[model samples]
Target: MKLRMKSLAVVMGLLVLPGCQNMEAVSPWIDVGNQVVKNAGYDTDSKLARGIKETLYTSTDRASTGLSQVGAFNLSLPSAARPVADGLRQFGLGSYVDQLQDAMNRGAEQAVAEAAPVFKQAITGMTVNDALGIVRGSDTAATDYFRRQTEAALRLRYQPIVEENLRKTGFYEQYKGLLAAYEKLPVAGKPELDLERYVIDQSMAKLFTRIGEEETLIRKDPVARGSLLIGQVFGGAEG
Candidate 1:
């Protein structure tokens, strides 16, 4: 009996030792993940700025296609805001649309160019906890957090630019024309169209969507798998 008890104790100790070490190793990953998320969140402005730049550059290439479909010289309109290389068949803007598209693209390019460094600086100021939450949450969580935190400030900062872009792209004029037509209709309770609000909402939605895509890629792709601590705490390799 004495021998059996001693043997049992020895086996239990061995088991506990490995378990403790495993737990310790796992703890650091959580910290690392938190740090990464926080960093990502803080840098969201930069990321968004970069995304805008890419979008604009790509849009420039598709400007002609947009024009052919719209028959208008306004690109800042909702119709021409479709993603690039995705075809311009849907905007239905009619002819001269290319001019609008090009101008819109140029304005977007300018806005991003002006905003990128500001966004970068903002991101650099994010806290570690903020980063962790973003890193650990859903793919779009970080972007969402950034938007929630910075939207007000960003709007204040970018509203003038958006207005300028709208004017430059002829959206301001076209929007007024549409509003005039709408006002003449006998419609009741027509919601006022705030162009600035609409543009900001649309731009933010697209930006978040792209961030979510990146998050999905990070979660599923083998190449990006190494970026997160997958198998240890969250479950084994199978989990």
Candidate 2:
């Protein structure tokens, strides 16, 4: 009885614990948008929006190619730094993890392209305060702001697109099968991870990394700004 109770306790704790592999690590916004700019009193063609659009137009395409390639996620800092949870790795689903990781990158690759217009529209809502904040903030400052404000919005806007694309590729089936296999193991406990949320968050993170890289480059070298307005706005920062 004690042993059974202890196992239950462990599973419950794992359920509640927050980490990448743990369910909660998927982000609250997952469990948790379109009129945002109109509500902010800025139209799609607003100056802030135009600036962001231009910046993104120049960068997003290149970012897509660079980041969407095979092995991209494995090469990212996030992969190395993200904790995979002891239980997940101990289950020894190494090949499953590899395939899942590849699927995540593939899903994200398309997501970035599909999300471009949404992100561009989202830029229309950026306020002067937001501009000042991003300019004065870190390299990924704008990306951070975008995540805070639009992750939920983006999720709503982007989820269907990602779902459709992944489904067509059989990515969803593969991921579900692997996860189901894992969960069937006597010691696996209830599956704690949300593969959809994990992929979405990772997609945004990688795109943000690309954006931050561009932002940092623009800040350091005048040539990369792609426009006078962006240069004047973000050029002074040392990031």
Per-residue lDDT of model 2, residues 156-196, tens digit only: 76577556655654457765687678767787344345566
How far is each candidate from the true structure, as Cα RMSD in Å? Answer: 13.0, 20.2
lDDT (CA) per prediction: 0.44, 0.53
TM of each candidate vs. truth: 0.46, 0.53
Clashes in model 2: which pairs?
A: none
Off by over 4 Å in 2: 1-62, 68-102, 165-192, 236-239
Displacement of residue 228 (Cα, Å) in model 1 is 9.4
Q: Evaluate model 2: give its TM-score.
A: 0.53
What value of lDDT does candidate 2 attain over all alpha carbons?
0.53
Steric clash count of candidate 2: 0
Q: Looking at model 1, which ten-residue stretch has the lowest summed lDDT?
A: 230-239
Positional deviation of 125 in candidate 1, in angstroms? Answer: 2.4
